[model samples]
Target: MTARLNPDLLHRPGLAAYRLSRALALSRIGSWHSYAVIATPRAGMPAMPKGYSYRIAAHMGEFEAVAGVAGVDLAVAQRRLDDGCVCLIASRGAAPVGVTWISLKPVREDEIAALYDCGGRAAWDLGLHIAPEHRASRAFAALWAATGDWLDMHGLAWSLSRIALYNAASLRAHARLDAQLVGRVQALQIGRLQWLRATIGGQTTLHLSGIARPPKLALAAAIMV
Candidate 1:
């Protein structure tokens, strides 16, 4: 999780290519891009910012109940349920208003499994979001505060997550929590051909390589559900 960017390359001529790549990936003959975030679990369960109720999904039924309010697809929710991933939910009164998932197993998304490592002391944090209507409140912070408590209880050392480069809001949300950028991944496609460039431990630079097929889901459809 301590992976650092290659400063020399990034500060030189690489910055332009990095920023310009987003435009080239706007179509089918486009690209896939994401960066990974790593954060250590902080102690204490701070009060849910606005008195919103916070709790963990103990079973599939709870996960399903929160799916709609959480704005997560039922199918996607079920897969996470089966994988033993836990969802932290915050409700405004009787309505579920925010959700976040914690996974101790491997990253289910194939595009990134080959790049970031997960398991043991490190856990993968999937979607973390507050409903559109509840965005103006402190529900996002409350949910994260709840997550820190949960992670500390489980003895986890690090929380890892991936966000699409284009998703500025999600990036800022995580950055506000003091997350460190530890991995870089991008896939450039032209018609039927796609190439991949991702973080490989021990390497300090991004290198593009050919791939037979691209992943069906590059990362989260929306940085958060």
Candidate 2:
């Protein structure tokens, strides 16, 4: 997976020093832990608002519309949709208000490998986003509930997702849906070398990758999203 850095950080001075410091810290210690939450049939879905509705996009046109409303790249979303990724779009009347992506196969962007090892019965939910104006409402929760329902209808027994440790809002949202924390993942990096470790309950696995780069080059290759 390609590392995506926040553009706002690029203009700041001492970026090299900052990147080096972060890399060193991560290598010696580790990046913040990301929690893996699971959704099952027993954890019932949430009720959407009176005027809101959710459905899987039926075509690229619908996907493009939703992507436009969500401020995401139309081409990227179309590619994912073409590759069999599912896009759930939530709308009020005829206007899209929220969108989420789900995958039955492995998604490299999520950077988690264990979920895919569970055979094709597992689903991964990612890229959940709600319009700012609808944030205070139950849109997100409703979308999640709909996703769970979709998973069940498809005969999938498990739904998995990773949330950053510092994302309290997301954690609370997942908690409200009765999602169980089944695992955690952390990353470490030094120069071009990077390591990713996952702990599912008591089991742990580590993966390492990267190219050789000058120690002082300060490549920001292991940033947390």
Candidate 3:
């Protein structure tokens, strides 16, 4: 019998606190703690691999092909489409296998929030997802290759993305790609008071959450429609 590995066990040393924080958050009794990583993907793209077809979604209807696979409904996907963000989806035959999203907009979007804004120079690498069944395949490389090609042709110099620090494997993978660490974010939520401190692009900022106030980075809920 082929034995499956417990992914968390592979990164046990670094996950104890991460898992504890998740548990605390689920229990709804204490502050949750975790680190957010700001990664700057350097100039260049991954090698294009075969076995998958790619689709780049720049508008509404185009995104529908992969919305369900990407985890957001059409409304949310359409909102992102209108925001100048692009989503690259991959499929094996007719099965959606992976997705990569990026943005060149300088303004914040309601879906992405402000903490993710990396600035004007870098295209926001909003997200990258590969179905578990395809995680071990070239789906990632193919998705990135297509994304990189698009970014290169669009005159974008680089891509900036946020990653959860507890994802050790992902962090390691990013390092292998020569992606630079741009900053770190720490946030805590307690009762009705929430706080966040971030240091990105050499600037440090703090924010207190409230219905009447937005993050210092985002003065108001972004209305792009």
Model 3 lDDT per residue over 51-108, tens place: 6778888887777766666866677677677767888898877788888788766434
Most accurate candidate by lDDT: 3
TM-score of 3: 0.75
Higher lDDT: candidate 1 or 2?
Answer: 1
**Model 3 CA lDDT for position 187:** 59
Give the Cα lDDT of each candidate. 0.60, 0.57, 0.62
Which is superior by TM-score, 1 or 3? 3
User: C-alpha displacement of 62 in model 3, angstroms?
Assistant: 1.6
lDDT of 3: 0.62
Q: After superposition, how far is residue 127 of candidate 1 from its true place, in Å?
A: 1.0
Report the C-alpha lDDT of model 1 over 113-191, residue by residue, as the tens digit: 2333463546677778678888887787778777876777777645767666555556555666656566556655555
Clashes of each: 1, 0, 0
Per-candidate TM-scores read 0.71, 0.70, 0.75
The clash tally of candidate 1 reads 1
Q: Mind giving the per-residue lDDT tens digits that candidate 2 earns over 50-134? A: 8878888846877765665565677767656765678888887877788888776555443322223333546767788888888
Candidate 2 runs further than 4 Å off: 1-42, 110-118, 190-192, 211-225
| lDDT, model 1, position 169 | 59
Q: Clashing residue pairs, candidate 1?
A: 25-31
